[model samples]
Every structure is written in structure tokens, then in C-alpha cells.
Target: MDNQYYCNRCDREFQNFNAIKSHYSDSHKKTLHYACSTCYQCFETEAALATHRRNNPGAAPHQREPKAT
Candidate 1:
């Protein structure tokens, strides 16, 4: 359908950007907002960024881990 949006990465179709973005973030582990300040890189989630920081300590300021409430 012309109104449907197609995801090239996953070959999935969505009704809108929000749906596609959500699908991409979950299925592809891609970031919609969170980013690395030093390299201007983005991650799918905070945990992914944390992993990156652990692997690359010299890259940028580390993002604080979420505190358990």
C-alpha cells in the first residue's frame, strides 16, 4: 500500500514513523535519541551505550547507570 511505510533493514511494514521507529529500536537495537557526546554516535538504548563506554573508556564521559528505585 502507498500509505504503508516499509523498513529496508528488516523488510517490515508499518503504518507510521512512530510504529517503524519503535520496531527498529526493538528489533534492530537502534537508537532514536540517546547519543554519544564525544563521537556524536547514537545507541538503541542506555545499556548499549554503557557497553560502548565500558569497551571504549577514553571515548567520552560515561553515562550514569540508572539507579534502582
Candidate 2:
């Protein structure tokens, strides 16, 4: 059996050892690309946009609230 590690941050699974290593170097290890210029906020992906929104509540418009009757 082959042994491999998983990355929860990127939500990716790897098979080859080299692939896993490179994925970490390119995605998980670095925060160079995942940055927001407007607020100087760092994020891993677009999904992280929501997290930034939470942190800087006054910086941007509030997230759409759930509708109520």
C-alpha cells in the first residue's frame, strides 16, 4: 500500500508522493497568490472571500442575510 498525506486547506487528495509535495508548495504552503488587493486580506481561495467578509465586517457590504417572513 502507498502512504500519502491529505490537505484539508485546499480540499485536495493526492496519490503520487511528488504530486502531494508540489501541491503543498504551490497551494497550501504559500500565501502569495491568495491575497486580496482591496483590503490587503489573505485567503486561500474564493471560498475564503466569505471568511474575509466576516473578519472585516465594516470594510465591505454585509453578506446577504437570510430572508424572513
Candidate 3:
């Protein structure tokens, strides 16, 4: 049997050896697109932003969550 590894962060799937390797380098290894100015925390997607907001009550609600992975 073969195994598969998926990136929850990027929501990408890999079936074979090379695809998984490329996915990690191309998606996971890159810097986050969204950043928290107050804490300088970086988030790869908007969903992460919402998760952070839940912990930060003072945060604005207008912030958007990244597309589902």
C-alpha cells in the first residue's frame, strides 16, 4: 500500500513522492501572506486570522478567514 500526506495549511494533496516534496517547498516553505501588525505574527491564510481574532477580542470583525483547506 502507498501513503499520502496532505498539507492542512495549504489544503493541497499529494499522491506520489515528488508531488508531496514539491507541495511542501512551494506552499509550506513560503512566508505567510497575512500579518498581525500588533504582534508581528504572520498567517498563511485568512482562516488563521479568524482563529487569532477569537483569542483577541479587541480585534476587528471585518477580518476575513482564508478559504477552507
Residue-level lDDT tens digits of model 1 in 1-69: 444645546667776545656776788876344444444334456776677678788886745323222
The lDDT values for all models are 0.56, 0.47, 0.50
lDDT of candidate 2 over 1-69, digit per residue (tens): 243334446656555434544675677664322333334333445567667676676765533322212
- For residue 20, model 2's alpha carbon misses the true position, in angstroms, by 22
Q: Better model by TM-score, 1 or 2?
A: 1
Residue-level lDDT for 67 in candidate 3: 26
lDDT by residue (1-69, candidate 3, tens digit) is: 234434446555456434544555576674344444333344556777568767887864443323223
**Candidate that beats the other on lDDT, 1 or 2, i.e. the better one:** 1
Q: Alpha-carbon error at 33 in model 3, in Å? A: 0.4
The pairs that clash in candidate 1 are 30-44
- The parts of candidate 3 lying over 4 Å away from their true place are 1-28, 60-69
